[model samples]
Target: MKIVTIFVMMMHITGSLCAQVLQDIKLNAPDMERGLTIMKAFGKRASATSFSSKDLSLQDLSDLLWASAGVNRPENGKRTAPTAVNAQDIDVYVLMKSGAYLYDAKTHSLKGVIAGDNRKMVSERQTNFANAPVMLVMVSDISRFRGDDTEQKLIWAAMDAGIVSQNIGIFCAGTGMVTRPRASMDTEGLKKLLVLSGTQYPLLNNLVGYPNE
Candidate 1:
């Protein structure tokens, strides 16, 4: 009886830990002027090959997300990146070493989507993106569009996500961090794993990490 009781207790403890939701993280505010200078300085984009194995801290993740698409104007919920018609519907699904999370720009939090290190899933043959410290999967909900035009939906989604991707690239460039953006990803696999709605489309993948220096 004692053994059974101990076993049950262990299961309960495990369940509790598994269910813990990571709270919102406070980000170190970015220097916008510096970022703009870096953006203008990058004459052309480049793909970084090597990366450090260090795990990104919560603060680091928060800063990256904030720079990518966090609310710049809390008074009206305006984001760092613009959306078509201000629909503000793109979701940045983060693939990290600990698990998967959906970045909530409004709350500056990472909403837990699944609990496991699925980072390798985002990598492709062109580059082992899994080695990078972080990857942001840009997903757009087609239903968020103001109209039912399919082509228009794709166009807007790509354009808006491109802006965020450039934000990330510029941030990396300024910080001496390495990065690469890829449009060719295993979108179908990710959709199934993420259980995305039919209208949701994974548009781009952005990889970021410290240079292997």
Candidate 2:
């Protein structure tokens, strides 16, 4: 009877922990009026050398993801960043201290992927970058592209990923935030952590935060 009681309590504790870790985040609408002008953002755009550890506000995070690759044209379901053949191959995974989430462009929200801090996998050898409050890891699912040539599909994936990363850079530059696009990360570890399929490849990542001033 005592053993049975202890097992039940342990199961209850595990269930509570799972609930805390896998909570989905419904993002807010993007603030259309915010940020600097296109020219100003272009001028200010530069790679950040350091980042603050402070977490971003819900609004800022919402805007950031929307700008990254959210659906800009609601009428046709088009996105801010264009992909080759409109494949929409790139997927942005948001890694924070709390958990990892996949940005659902159609719904403009974050779908919880896994629980616990996985930023270390994105930071990899650049341990310093782990301090950034948020990390956006870009993964491309080549299977989305309708092509027989695997090599050409991979090329398109790279280009599409770069476009999304650039959007992230410009948004940060204009919005008084800091970010740096990088190719360094534990790809194999991320694949296992995120449970990525064989067709999905993590190509790039961006460390995002306020300047450590």
Tens-digit per-residue lDDT, 119-192, candidate 2: 99998888877899999999999999985899999999999999999999999999999999999999999999
Off by more than 4 A, model 1? 1-36, 39-45
Cα lDDT tens digits, model 1, 1-213, are 999999999999999886654444445564454443654538544677777878776656767788889999999999989999997868999887767888888778887777676667688665555688788999998788887898988899899888989878877776566678888778888898788999999999888888788
- The prediction achieving the highest lDDT against the true structure is 2
TM-scores for every candidate against the unseen true structure: 0.84, 0.94
Judging by TM-score against the true structure, name the best candidate: 2
CA lDDT, candidate 2, residue 183: 97
Backbone clashes, candidate 1: 0
Deviation in Å, model 2, residue 109 alpha carbon: 0.4
